[model samples]
Target: MAAVRIRIDLAYDGTDFHGWATQPGLRTVQGELQAALATALRLPETWVTVAGRTDTGVHARGQVIHLDVEDEVVIESAGRAKEPPLATLVRRLNGMLPADLRIHRAIEAPAGFDARFSAIWRRYAYRVADQPALVDPLRRHEVLPWQRPLDLSRMNAAATDLLGLHDFGSFCKARDGATTIREVQQLVWERDEAGVAVARVIADAFCHGMVRSLVGCLLEIGDGRKEVAWAEQILAEARRTSSVHAAAARGLTLEEVGYPPDEALAQRAEQTRGRRVLAE
Candidate 1:
């Protein structure tokens, strides 16, 4: 008779959905999740909360969310004498969900698995093309096609300016209640096996448009259009400038989130992030 916690690992292409949140008459990740839960558990739409809300045209590979429901609904309940297995729940959700959305994994969560609050870090990857010939038509939505040859060395140098904690207001969209300052734990620009330019960033948190704005600035440096000091100057100024042109959202992906082995890792990450904000 006790309530159970359910954690779902899911992914979806944001092209078809209007971001992650539910809206009136609009298709969204939350809307699909609510419907799936409703059919599987015979519940209503008000029982789910996601860890993050991505913007339109974005994508996620390892998004996590938690829901509270009756034990019989999640297949782990001892109260249900004849319920199906957890795997069946996953299979059923996938069968009912659309092609673009999938249930990557599902499980009964541990006692304190607060999806949003317990996360330590989030990682994202952005891909940009330096050569037009290398782009495959099939992968166009997932990679930005930049025909101009880029200077990898210059891009890497510019990225160095963004490696530490700073107020990234220039690169982020202003939010009424959210903070623009964040601790960037890792950032790099390099060529991958296919010789395509890639940008990777990891941080405890990100503000709206932060990753895209960062990419916009990095591209300028790579194209010989700006100096490395330009990145530093923009950060120091802490204001949006015409130079920051974010790449298409479809080229970015939410790679993964870092969680502590125990609560200590989360605590450490939170403290580090807090200090970074204050110093900024």
Candidate 2:
């Protein structure tokens, strides 16, 4: 029997979990999903790998994971091909797991689909509270509250200098094997209907604390505390600089992941990742 591949779409409030990886005696997305899979398949704890490893207090709306199952599991489900009979799995998992985690969808993934490596681009949204009033109670978990009025024009101008490829050491947490280089495809700051300030960044990849630090510097520029050239100046340093500030993690959300629309997209993404590896 051949190995079967399964893809799962999931979302969770990360306030309670330590992170995505499984650690003994700690609740994690991978840990919970592996437990559920083991129970459903009557196998030992195994066969689940995620596309992203989100940090504590970070939330995801469309996270993906891949699992390999025994052939029997796949064969038995082949008759009902339109939709996998994963509703039962979702229900069972929900019943056993804590309320914060949820299995949004479960189905068979395309052949050779690698959850992490196959991803083309990752997008993140960061929210800042610029109003003098306290943050709304409802958004406290997801938005960072900053009382200072920010200059949007200034923030955008500084962020523009960071649009292309650059060594972003100033924005990253120091770590071994962590290269501070990344390509920021898009960056924008805007006000939502509720008038909350939102910073959206899309990139092929991000280093640890990169987004938060970027937000911090941009906010400073917005508030006129720092010059518009500050972001660029620090970025040119090509190493961690004390001048950059890191925003609160709670305000960041993994908004979405970009994939190739067709086979061509997949090819292009692979090429891009390959080049990234070479550059590193």
Candidate 3:
């Protein structure tokens, strides 16, 4: 049977999810999403590939994924004859998914789109309310309440030293056989409209715990606990250190993922999948 690749754009509050991946006995975004897709399409099972895998309590505003299904299954199970299969699938999946998760759109994927590797960059934002009074009750789950006041200038100065391609071992949880080298396209700290300190980080990809750890280290500098030079020193160390702890997961949100033009999609995917190494 012929298969059609479907692309799904979604957003979710990750507070109640274990993470993006399916884990045994854990309620996860992947587990919930896959189950709903199967039920909606009347399929035995289906698997999806995500643009990036977020950690527990890390939210996403622009997550993307792709899955292949038999063409006949989509058409026959759509329920409404007039509506397109992809549109019906979106409505059905959202109806069954929990309130925290929502599918924004579902459509046929462009040729050569891999969801994961076809992307050029992933952007994330971390929010911290340094002053107790600045913490909004409604956004408490998404923002970190910091005990000490933060110096945004100091944080941005410290952040400047960590950008560009480098081995980010100090900021990442060591993973077997996975290189810690990554190209950071952007990293900066600034205050948002509500006076909350926000760190915007964009990179080709991130290793486990990189963003949170970077935030934690920078926070130390922001609060005057660590010197401005400390960030560069840690990066030079090229391995995780005892001084750096990953910031609370709740503060982080994956805000966007960027992909190349259609003609470059396959090439970009192939390049991203290649093994990366940084020169000494």
Candidate 4:
């Protein structure tokens, strides 16, 4: 049987896991999922490619991954159950997976699909509750509780200065030979009915710690600690600074990832790979 690739939609609380990549002795989303897949499919081992690698305490609602396996293996894994092979796989995986992680859907991937390289953009949301009344005790794992009152208007104004293409070295954790240049399509803040300030960020790609660091910078502006122009100045410097530490990871969540149509997937993947190599 031909090897087939499957696209998977998943979500995780991310409160206890040690980020997405596997470590030698530490827990990770990738390690856990790979193990579960191997056991379910009766394979010696399994590996997966993820759309994004999140940090500790960060959550995800629309995360994506791709896995490859023999077509007959997937079919037989269902064990004559009255469901599609992929559906049975999903059910089996959920039963084996921990409560913090969930496999939402799985299906045969369209031709030329590469979960990470084919992605056009990724969207993330950061939730912060500044006032005492707005803080929800039940959601402490997901929302950030702040002492100072935040001004959404100020945060939005500061976020606007960060829009468009630029070298975002100031907001990223140093990575050897990695390019920090990215195009931010949107960086805006708004208050929900519950009065939580949510930062919506969309970008072509993000460097390590980019989203949380961006939110940290905006948080100071919202609380009147830093002037609105501060964000722009640091961005222009294009170097990391001690003043702008990353926000708590709990507040951040990967909400969505965008991809071009099936026909363009292969082209997009090639283009993205070339750009990164050139930039590096």
Candidate 5:
């Protein structure tokens, strides 16, 4: 009757859901996944911890979550299949999940595996169709339409000064008792084959609305409305200002989540539990 922790790698089109958390009446990724998991595993209820809690319209390509379930149930889920239990579990999960959501992999978690806390960094990508010709109607849900064409070089240049550890208060929504200090490992803009601008931002952890706000600020510089120094000046002030607009959530996607080696998971989780503060 021992319980086994399971790690799930999945993706979802967040166009219609109300984000990742469960709500009383609204449809959410967490709610849908938990209901499907409970039905597939024949459990009364299920709970999962997610690596990142995305906004309502934001999508995800490489999301991670963890749950604990009875060991017998997992094996029994295979149900006469010759494949491994984990493989069967994933296959069965996908069958039960809605078309917008998918289960890529599901396996027994290693010791100390905590999906949220064990994550070392998260990568998010935002796509913008700055011109009418570049806007594709077929992919309307994931891309944002902008008023002006974006300059990739300008956005990349302006992103350099915002890298490394800094208080991102100007780019984040205020949260009680939460520090906005974060280490931005990467922030670069590039154009896709369709001539749409794409921004890839990676950070140890993002405060609420951090990536969207950063993209909004860089977008102005990319369009020649704001100078490169504006980004640095905002960071130096470390306070939220009206100049930094939060880009549309539909444009942003959680691309990946990085984690340390299995042996370090416990330590990393413990370290992440402490509240962060900027050094004086």
Candidate 6:
């Protein structure tokens, strides 16, 4: 039987899991989800491909993944005759998953849809409460509390200079053989009604540790510790620097991922698979 590609939209509180990927003896979102799916379908263990691999303690509101399984596995009802097999799978998996994780939807994927490679952009938001009064105890898990007050004007000004395509090595954890170059479609700082500082960062893709490192550098500039010119200087270096610390993972959340239309999925995937380099 032919394999069926399934698209799953999920959300998770990453505080408990090690991260998105699975590792020996570690609790992870992928590990738990895969285990639950395998059990529900009565099939062997399977792997999933995610659009974004968030770091430890990072949350995701719009995470996406895809997995391929034999058609028979998806159609098996497991004695639940009331609903279709796909619906049954969703209901059963949700029953087995922990409270912090949720599978929002499951459907047959469009042709050529790849959760990771076909993605056009990923949008993330970082929340920081610079003033003690603005920090809400209920939101402590998702927001970062900082001792110093932040200047929104300064942070926005610094963020403006960092937009557009460029090498972001200075803001990424160095990984061997992985390119540090990325395109920043949007990076803006604003204060919400609650007076908490929010940074909305949209990029074609982010290298490992890129979003938090960018937030850390901007926080310094907002608090008067670093000059506005500092961000530009760091970008010019095109290499990682110790001066920028990755912001606490608790403040970051994967907001959304964008993809091309159904007809263009394959083309987009092909384009993304090519090695990326800054134009000369």
Q: After superposition, how far is residue 56 of candidate 5 from its true place, in Å?
A: 0.8
**C-alpha lDDT values of all predictions:** 0.79, 0.78, 0.94, 0.93, 0.92, 0.92
Predicted candidate 1 versus true structure: per-residue lDDT over 1-280, tens digit per residue: 7787778888888788888888999998898878887887655554676666788888888888888887755654223445445666777789889998898877887755667766778889888777877797887777888868989788888788887778888998887766778889988877889987888889878888899888888888888888988888899878777778887898888878776665464555355444344542
Expressed as tens digits, the lDDT of each residue in 1-280 for candidate 2 is 7877777888888877777888899988778878877876667667677776888788888788888887686456344545545665566667777778878877777754767767777889998888856479888889888878877878888889999888888888888876677889988899888888999999877888888889988988898888899888898887888877788778988888766654554565466455343245
Per-prediction TM-score: 0.90, 0.88, 0.98, 0.97, 0.96, 0.98
Between prediction 2 and prediction 5, which has the larger TM-score?
5
- 89 in model 6: Cα distance from truth in Å? 1.6
lDDT digits (tens) for residues 132-244 of candidate 5: 99888998999999989788888898999999999999999999888898999999998889888999899999998899999999989999999988899988889899988
Error of 6 at 164 (Å): 0.9
Candidate 2, after superposition: displacement of residue 112 in Å?
3.0
Of the candidates shown, which would achieve the greatest TM-score relative to the real structure?
3
* Candidate 5: regions farther than 4 A off: none
Q: Model 3: per-residue lDDT, tens digit, 11-83?
A: 9999999989999999999999999999998988989999999999999999999999889999999876578
Candidate 4, residue 13: how far the Cα is off, in Å: 0.3
In order of TM-score, best first, we have 3, 6, 4, 5, 1, 2
Tens-place lDDT per residue, model 4, 114-149, is: 999999999999999999998899989989999999
Using lDDT as the yardstick, the better of models 1 and 2 is: 1
Weakest 10 consecutive residues of candidate 4 by summed lDDT: 271-280
Candidate 5 or 3, higher TM-score:
3
> How far out, in Å, is residue 228 in model 2?
0.7
Write one digit per residue (lDDT tens) for candidate 6, span 1-280. Answer: 9999999999999999999999899999999999998898887787899999988899999999999998887876456567777777788889999999998888899999999999999999999999979989999989999999999899889998899999999998889898888899999998899989999999999999999999999999999999999999999998999888889999999989999999999999999998898899
Per-prediction backbone clash count: 0, 1, 0, 0, 0, 0
Error of 3 at 194 (Å): 1.0
